[model samples]
Target: MTINRRKFLGATVAASAALSAPMALAAGSGKPRVVVIGGGAGGATAARYIAKDSKGEIDVTLIEPTRTYYTCFFSNLYLGGFKEMDELGHSYGGLAAAGVNVIHDWAIGVDRDSKQVTLAGGAKLTYDKLVLSPGIDFVDNAVAGWDVTAQNAMPHAYKGGSQTELLKAQLAAMPEGGVFAMVAPPNPYRCPPGPYERVSMVAHYLKANNPTAKIIVADPKPKFSKMALFQEGWANNYGGMIDWVGEEFGGGNVEVDPNGMTLSIDGEVVSVDVCNVIPAMKAGKIAEIAGVTQGNWAPVNAADMSSKADADVYVLGDASQQGDMPKSGFSANSQAKVCANAIRGALTGSRVFPAKFSNTCWSLIDTDNGVKVGATYEATDEKIAKVDGFISSTGESSEVRKATYLESEGWYSGITADMFG
Candidate 1:
């Protein structure tokens, strides 16, 4: 089954209400323990909700290597010079203060049978339940002649933080009239409209700094999210600066030489100053290590996001193969709340509300010009099914577009606050 791609408010209400309830500890263990790996949108939110809602009844440990988590959601804005790197970075201190044991360390192995996680620092953590929300990792050889080793040269910047900064720096340093190329990913990748939004942002940047620069996109898919809207925005905002090659035009048949800095499309090679290669993605390594993954993703029951392989294991966000929800930060945060409630119920006998989800993806095309596509969802036996949806149109008024961008700013503020504190 194909998942529908898209975010809204419900978080502030849910967070405040959950804090009001007091849950009792499970009878068997001193405290029902939940160990979450990868402290991003899904893991951080899940850890915070379980700890906050459980009210000392459950022990929550979040194991993450990075102390400052950079959000992938708005990193494109950083590329466009609209946001700073610090704006995208959030410290884990909030989770630590919320009675969550926030450990800055890598979770190297998951012994599902033993109910233990081994850390790179040579420590072991035992848990009654394990939540994996490790976002995404690129598939091996998904893009020919490119790998993690070539990242410094080609720079996918798909993940956040340093990579994003590197990409922006490369963009800024490009020679006048130099080429900027992007090898777009296949379907089921993170953020359906991300690449196009990025192109728009890059164009915005170059138009101001290096007006003669050219932007090229080789997309494997025949089309993409918010296609008409994005195309229209490109034509209006960055005329004659962007060229998009879809699958029929051999965009799918491509290769990159990182060392030589050349991108070859349909056997036609051209040297580019900067190339952003977003490869196919899959669930992070920890899920596969836990033996909860079926193939590239971990399959979960739609109701509670419990692993199909292990009852005690749950997967959230981009790592999950639950039906009909796109791989997105907003989707992950939504899934985290549902997973948190279900886990709280199973461990502490707290009320487990029916699982419902929602997501909104807001993309900035130019200054004060934002467009979005979003939907609400409900959990079913089959998957997280889409209920209703909405999108910004092609020819919206300037006031409408500006309002949409401002709305996105508000969402970013709300969601981050919801996740961190």
Candidate 2:
């Protein structure tokens, strides 16, 4: 029906009110009821598209804990003082207006055999097909003394929301010439270049206000996305203001005391003005309970994002293990579109088209300057493979960098619109 933002918001309100309505009245006796878990990039997109493209033949229910979502994609700009939190946060009103049932609740568990989801409120929802995109959960014991309580003392801020705001506050409160420590997690996490991008953003702020402030990146991996480019940029721009320690230099070392505001690396205790510890990650707890996660992430067929463990369930975004595709928001959003199409085809006995996906991640080195990495992929034999893309050229021109920034903004708008509008 060509729904836009205003119409989408109206739909969300109507759908929310209909939640208490009788099932027959809510479904209207024809549409198939599809329940979606989580309302970030993956679930929101799935709900919007399934409701819109199905032409009222499908009733979509979205379960999420929050009404608003703050994206991690452009959060670095917020840290650089170039953007406000409101600019990064988006409301679910648009999705509501799209005829999707938006429920503000956390899903406690899923019954794969019965095709039902149980919420903490004792509400039970049965679905013909279920889509899960619950995102990642941090591994508390990845480092000693690092747990839920420890996270407050050393903000990971990877998932955005309160943790993000806390990290920002800590940065603002740090003394001049103080130390900021960032412990980058191992590979297969939500965002590979996120820690480094944050380093650049914080360095940009420190250079102007606290020039003597230091940023130490203790990375588990020896190399990271666009390592050479980031190194060159830091050396030329920040001039020794940032130091990166790879695995060779004891960067992999980690021990923490949540109460003492101290971290030990290689048995040497170090105290910093601020600390950001990004622990290892796995699929959300629900995914584990549903028997979808193999080790840390759920395994799915690349062609349709169908869970190998359960035929009726689909997993996308950071929770699924899609080879050659980094767990970034752009990738998740793109994958959701593909998965949505696959679900529709499967339900209607239509031919499911082969899947192709794309991703782009932009990181700002400073205001008015940024870098990007992107890739396009095709699925074959249940695995995704990269086709083509570009990493920002080293020492690219000002015009090129600016163009990338604009393109990234456009991508964010377009992807969000595709999911919610």
Q: Best candidate, TM-score-wise?
A: 1
Reference-based TM-score, model 2: 0.92
Expressed as tens digits, the lDDT of each residue in 143-189 for candidate 1 is: 88999999999999999999999999999999999999999999898
Candidate lDDT scores, in order, read: 0.91, 0.81
Candidate 2 stretches with Cα past 4 Å from truth are 1-30
Residues 156-242, model 2: lDDT tens digits: 898868888898899999998998888889988987778888999899888988899998887879899988778877987899899
**Clash number for each model:** 3, 5
Mark the 10 consecutive residues where model 2 has the least summed lDDT. 18-27
Error of 2 at 308 (Å): 0.3
**What's each prediction's TM-score?**
0.97, 0.92
Residue 201 error, candidate 1, Å: 0.4
Predicted structure 2: lDDT:
0.81
